[model samples]
Target: MGLSKRNRWRTLVTASVVFSLVVMATGIALANITLWMHANPTFVSGTEKLISNFEKENPQIKVELVVFPYPDLAKKVLTGILTGDVPDVYQGWGMWFIPYIRTGKVSPVPSWVTTAEELEEKFQPSSLGAYYYKGKYYGISAETNFWRGGLHVNLDILEQAGLTIPETWAEIISSGKKLTKRDSDGYIIRAGLTWINQDNSNSQFLAGIMQNGGNYWDEQGYVKLNTPEAVKSLSFYRDLVLKHEITSLTIDMSAEVHEVYFKRLAAMLIRPGWVVSIIKAQYPDLRSAFVALPSIGPEPPYYPAETGWGYQVPAAASHKEEAWKFVKFATLDKGASRAWLTEAFLLPALKSLEDDPELLEAEKLVKVAFSQLKYGRYVGDMGSRERFTQIIFNISQEVFTQKTVVKDAVAKMEKEINEMLKEYR
Candidate 1:
């Protein structure tokens, strides 16, 4: 009897193990498909809602979102790509995608994208034009921003100086001189105008170049940094300190330039449109106005430097089709795009949503941002963009700090940029 009972116990244990294995296999086969996505954390809540809605509608597809701080997301994604553990979809900038594209790590937008002309018609020219690389589309614009180079003026300060908003570079210099203040020892007590002394100095320099009817690159993709137009642009920027004395390196190297403006130590600043929101939020009582950067030359077409971010799918994505579906749903769907606009205050990339009543009702600064979209020109979308910008920034700093002559500075920049472009050739 004892032997029989032991035999029965062994039989029961073996049967239970077999049943568990069968159940596990079935569960694996029936599991929901998960799509991994990464993006900046700014609008995670809205994105979560969109994901939830998508899952409810599709029922079989699940989306897993990983949010990272904007500054760190690129590095995180690049590491993931190396480890072959990348998300199915991720956020990227126009220039940031170039390295990935060169490695064949990024897939072009699905064949459904059809002709390039259709894409231009479907999205805003500047926003959609950004993602076109080497005759193919690799991504879609998630948000369009056109506030590259604008003059942010403290209206009260200008009024106190008995000046009106200036429309030309000469007028700005004239006004800036009067608005500038000095101490008894000839020290700069207040700056009349300032530029943010950060990476954005590249955009400011580019705006000057573009307004002077020059571009960073020619049709053959050569660096034009030392051209006559570029020299004029860089010289004008240098003279704002060394010649006109309207601004000083002491002010630029001090606290953040916007902070200087907020403290009423500066009468005007040349920066992007987003500064309007910052000023409004931080100093509501301070009167301010926004205008296009004054023309550096007499020209019919003065372009504003344009920059934006977008979404792309990895070529190695395990769920390319499903990822494309999500990308379409998130960026092309009216509700999803509307959520981005209403919640995150991003400018709409879709042409259809440009005139939406809801967007029109956004902050005055946002409306002003939309108005400038027509003048937007792509900036820093080439390969090695960050390195190029750093080089330009350093050159500008040398001029600003009186360490190098403008002629010498542009020549050095031209040589370095040409060497940098050789890899592309």
Candidate 2:
């Protein structure tokens, strides 16, 4: 009786093991992977289509997408990090992932997932570099934006004034003078140039410094803001209002709030290339053009290209393999990639998509933006982007208000940034 019982137990254990292997082979045991993204209707639509196709191709896998509001998305991600409950995949701004990467919870893209040759041949260097650190790449770029050197022109306003698109800074000022309109009280009824907010101001400042042959980052990636170039950049913006008189302090032409650019209250707005998408979607009927800002110095114009946002798999994820599969599919699959680019109104990070004839022909503005990518200088690899941006914003406001002169403001900026970098050093 004891021998019979032993045989039966062995048979039962063997059968159970076989059944588990069969389930694994059929992909029945692991079928779902989770993804997190910020809320945007166009983005959500694009993702939904991509997921649908991904699921069709891999019938055994299902994707569960979790959308959060823009402001709350980072908070939710932080909570997930603390609790070790991260989604299988997370899509976020490239720079925003820097902190998480240092925590060691973000998985580096495996060699099997993407070969080095494909990585180099397919994607933009700056776009891919956003997720690179210490010789490891952590994510794939979904979208990119060159925030420097784009001068957005309201063609209707330009046409009414009988002026063509201004190429150089000298032309910008001269044309701005002609475009400015004043009321009976000498208050600005229309602004010839609109700076809008700190975001645009900071971008223009970086461009200005580069134009004047100055760099915000040195060879060792340390902050270098206390220079003549920095002061000159800040002064230029100040002069736009006080010295040049093209921009007015009272004109509330904020892009988000007033949209004075679209309303024809502003003739020209200095903005990033990606803003063209917003213009196309929101004001399709409004005639507009985006031209590269001509070189201010003898050297070529340098643009700050940031890897906007992309997808990554978490180290703590339950289904990392499935998650990576989705990430690869989302970023590399041609049809899905095209759909995402079109729906999201994003600039292409892939080399193949850069010259998509249909996309270029349909959106002439995008073509102009793409042509400017040759001058792109990748600035997304640094961890100090937010802190540096804040300092620039603060100094720009002070200078514009005349509470602080350009020299003092640049000195303050350099001091604050270097002080912040001490911790990293």
Candidate 3:
């Protein structure tokens, strides 16, 4: 009798615990519970607001966003792949995720959602190429970028000098010489234009290379940094800084170039369309106008396409079916796509919204960006993009700093690229 009584008590306690767990889960899901997710460093001030709006629309799914820094995203993602803890979805640089793709680690997207033919028509060829590899598609382009680096001219400075927007680089160079001013102690108080550091974080100098009809990669897939065309491109800018008063190197002397435009220290400088927010925020005093990147030579048509990042899904995604819904909503939603482009300050890489009113208005500044997609070349990036960029960055610096001959830079670049390609190819 004593043993039977103890068994009943144990059974009663177990049933009570199981009942509580079920009720708790039901309440959490039915009432409100966040779906844990992660995102890249792509959004600006209104990221939370956007998520809140998304939640209001889809009350069943609450997104808890963890935005990673751009520089560190690669390492974090690599770890997640190893540990099998990646979030639902995340954004990545367009070309940088090439290596992760080779392991069959990304979710295999079904053809019905975004058929291959439809994808081709939706995005520009170059944007489509960014996500395609070996008959498989790992991701889709979320934004478009190009290489029309232009001068963001401070209107206040132009007005002060009684000047007008310049049409060509020659005019800008001459005007720069006139606009530059120095203190008696020989420190430049301001420059007509500033040469912001052109290494990795920004590919500003590629505009010159493109204008001259020279490319970073040669026909045989070798680095071509020291080519005659490349030398001329670098020489043009070096001369401006080292010899002429047309421009100044930004690392040491300039204020945040974005902020300087408003402060009037720089009449014009080479930068992307995306910096407008920072410029508007930090220097509200400045009025500005943009002109196409100054032409380099008379004959060759060279406008490098803007290089934008992309969003990708991991092969190890635990809930790929659910994850793709988020990708579709975030990257392809007609309403969301337009809003994201406006909020994130980028060009739409999707096709459905070409006539989208909101995207049409905000992205008007980058109307010339798509033309770059035609002549744009991304080396080794369809699979090994990071290596491709690193090699170019190193070679570019070598040429700019006068450390290595173009021939030597090209040779070194070939070795680096081939090594990186060996894994993906």
Candidate 4:
């Protein structure tokens, strides 16, 4: 009986060893997916939940999320790609990733995406088109932003001045003059209207150019910054600072223009809808309203500058299949997308979710913004988008600082832009 008991104990020990080995093997087989995205409270929380749900369904896969500040994200991604330490999936601005796509470093959608048309059908045309290059897609849009300029008014200031919301450009200028206040020393106590010169100069210029029926590129892809329409647009913008003196040239670059408005230093600011959330969060007691900026030249074909961010997989990623699975879950899955919309307050790329309950509720607060999207123009698809925007900003700065006349500035801008384009040609 003692010999029998010894044999039984040995059998139990062997079984325990076998079970532990199987558990270890399973752990080794599980794919670890790493994703890099801009760090935001909503994004971090929503993505954490997504990973939890995904892992539950996919027992053989584990996901790791990495977050970085918005400004630092591009540099980090470039470094990762060069060092072969890139994430399985990365979220980036469309313009920044376009160059990578050209270099064949960003992978096209998986083989499952058989055709461009199939992919296009899944997203808004303009949003998806941002990631399209040379008849191929390198990324998928998760959120689309229609960043049209809108007049953000301080209701308290307007009420104090007994002024109504401006309906036209003339009215805007007139109201600006009325609302501007100065001390006896000629120092501006409050600016009537302000534009975020440092951050949004390019977007403001582009919107004005498009509204005046100007094209940034010709049929042959030549820069047209010196066209008559462009001159009118730049001159109008310049006059807002120098000629009309509606705003002050002495700006606090450290703070965003919206922050200036929130501090009650500015009565009006022309910016995108994102400011609504910023105001609601930081200055909840401040009364603010957003109205669509009136079209510059009234005829037809008015357009507004648009920009967005999306997800792309690097070609060098070791787990493309697993990466694609996560991408689809984050962007295309209904529950995941809803969570993002509710948490992040971003516009949905998927057409079906346009009327989603969460989006519907959010839309009520940004009615003007929703209306503006119809006129939105995607700026990312343009070749050399980053270079073009920088040149535009430089030209605007020259005009604002009184360094160059609008005519001369446009001419210099056109020349510089063409020089950049020659490389692509």
Candidate 5:
């Protein structure tokens, strides 16, 4: 009977151990969270390190990163929402989030993740633009993205041309004339200023208008692109090709403008802070400096800007609490936030980190970009920013080709964009 009692006790102990193992396995299984982001080389490496650290801290949790190509990410998330198969967490663009918010696919960040007051206190009000919608906050601000403000100067080229950095619109034009190099056949061997690339032209154009005291959006919050300011903006860019003869549309139309700048075919390219990483990583020998764009108008320059990228939880998220833990860790935690900004070459969205000595020392260009934040103009009310951008590009092409006049080009842009806005409105 004693032997029998001993065997029974052993069996009970074994069962208890098995049950504990099962419970632990279940906890881990439920803790798995998926994060989605665009596949940007700059953002990926840092994200991997953060994920590893996050998993270590929360042993019960695991994170799987889902990367889509940069251009395809917006569509992928929108489709995922329709299918109710979105990731637990994802990186969101400021203007792109409007559709997700309208669809109710993204959740308002719960108080547990971050209180509204805490968010306001920790982040610069402008940096939080992307995550806020009509009366609701959706995510944590991760980066401050200034789309087209920094004028990246090739120092070697400028010094060779015997000119300093351009400080005003007139100076830029004059410098362009002096710096442009043409071959025997009158083909431009090197460009003075390269600004009309597909990726950035719209923002630059809009900045031109805003700088000239034009409003892209009317008082009623609809797109208003056909103003005199817009016409002047387009005319100036066109003259850069036809009148000034500094840069050619053919070269810019065929290749990436950044590549043109990198190859030394273009002396200056309008870029954002992130290019500091690309330059340091790819072209270490290239002598470069980033400065605020030369004043574009009689008034102070206006920069068309937006929230760069941030983290958000989907309303359809399965592991919300776990997801928020990762979000809070990645964004609000000082070490992780600093690591991300440093690795990704992004500007700080947090006020505290804006002047952090270590960060400033690491990324000196960030200070120049940060100083221009006062002139940042956000068009948060656009019905469809993607469509708006496409229209601007189309108008640019038409105006440059002389297929349409500047006034006609902007008018066409205005009409097409307003039509697209109807659906969102």
Candidate 6:
């Protein structure tokens, strides 16, 4: 009886092992059937075309696209990434990539698949830096943007006032006094320029400081918010508001804030390329134009601290090879430039695209912004530089609000920075 029971037990154990393998394989198959993606909720100009084109070629891959408003997307994407329920591929900030690098979840771009030399031969050196880590590539390169935020001057209004776009900070201050208009009722009948704030729609402060030869952080990456130079830049901006372009104590935070730009009531604004859309929409009858921002206490040959907004891949993607295949088909090789030049307005990061007669021959106006990508900046890959951006914002708020003067702001910023640096150091 004992010998017969042993044989029966062995048979049952063998059956259990076979059942487990079947279950595991079945689970993987179910997971592969589902692919997910998300974008900022409302489909805007460039993003809409990208999604449509990516889907057209990748029809076999079922992508479940989710859209959240900008605020909701930021919160949800952050939470979702940490919890490990991340999408196979997603759109995320290029600056915040360092944290994701630590989790060992991100897939490195395979060296054998595409050599670095080959990539460099094709694309601009800077855009590739966004997706690179410690000299090795991580995320797939999508597109590039410029950091040329400047006071998009309303030349129409300036001309009406018999003034020209000011070349220097002193000119800006003087021109504002001449151009500013008001009524006896204390309402701005027609303002010389608009005072910019630290609002969501605009983060022109960083670029403004840069334009004035002021550096955001030292080489070691400590916040030097109170540098004599940065302070001078901010002081000029402050004066522009308090002395001229003075509006109500409360800012007009509406879709129409941009409408103010087109009506030519406001003379100058530190805005981006997309501001032209507002001009076309609201002030169709008026002519709008853009120019380089004024320079001051900052360095010469001005550069706006550029922040790249592009596409990235999550480490959680099970089929990285296939995912990369899709990315390459959409964002790399001839595919990347061809899609952008033909369907979307994005200047291709690849150098080869510059030679593309289609891109070269396309419209004339697009070329101006497209060529500017060559001078754009890329945030460093070192430590959590993004966490450092908050340090900047905090010190900036204090300085702007007059809670702390320039010198104190820099010292306070350095102290706070060293505290944060201890972990990395």
Model number with the top TM-score: 5
- Higher lDDT: candidate 1 or 6? 1
Flag regions of model 5 displaced more than 4 Å.
1-30
Give the C-alpha lDDT of model 1: 0.72
lDDT of 1 by residue, 1-425 (tens): 35598898999999988766765554322123333334434356556877777765554466777777666877777776667778888766656676766667787888664356766776777676556778998888766765455778889989987889887778889998999999999988888898757555776667678878787777777777877788888887888888999996788678878788888888888766556656655689989887767567555335543446677888778877777777787778777777765554567778888877766676455465566666667664455877787888888888888899888998898888778878776
Sequence-dependent TM-score of model 3: 0.78
Tens digits of per-residue lDDT, candidate 6, 1-425, equal: 35588788998898877765665544322223123333422224344555556555554444445565554654565566677777666655455555665556666766655667777776666566656666776665555545445456767677888888787767776776777677797666555656444331113445556656666666775455556665565555555555444432223333244556665566665554546544544456666565555444445434442334445556666666556655566566575446544433445666777657776555232454554555555544435564565665567566556687666765676677667766765
Query: Candidate 4 lDDT, tens digit per residue, 280-357?
Result: 666789898888888766433345334467789998998998888888787778778767655545667777777676
Which residues of candidate 4, in runs, are more than 4 Å off?
A: 1-29, 40-60, 111-115, 252-254, 299-301, 304-307, 380-384
Q: Give, for candidate 1, the lowest lDDT window spanning 10 residues.
A: 27-36
How accurate locally, in lDDT, is each candidate?
0.72, 0.77, 0.61, 0.75, 0.80, 0.55
> What is the alpha-carbon lDDT for the whole of candidate 5?
0.80
lDDT of 5 by residue, 1-425 (tens): 35588899999999988866775656454468999998878788879888988876676788999888988999888888878988999987877877788887888988988888888898867677767777779888787767875788899989988889887768878888888888999888888888776557787788888878888888766778778898888887889888988877766766778778888888888778788788888899999988878556776777676776888788899998999999999888887888888876787778888778888777776568767766776656567777778878887888788798888888898889889888888
Query: Positional deviation of 1 in candidate 1, in angstroms?
Result: 38
Best by lDDT: 5
TM-score of every model versus the real structure: 0.79, 0.86, 0.78, 0.86, 0.89, 0.72
Query: In model 6, what lDDT does residue 54 have?
Result: 57
Model 3 stretches astray by more than 4 angstroms: 1-42, 46-50, 198-205, 250-264, 298-307, 352-357, 364-425
Better of 3 and 4 by TM-score: 4
**TM-score comparison, 1 vs 4, better candidate:** 4
Candidate 1 residue 317 C-alpha distance from true site, Å: 3.4
Clashing pairs in 6: 41-68, 105-315, 122-351, 212-298, 213-298, 213-299, 214-298
User: What clash count does candidate 6 reach?
Assistant: 7
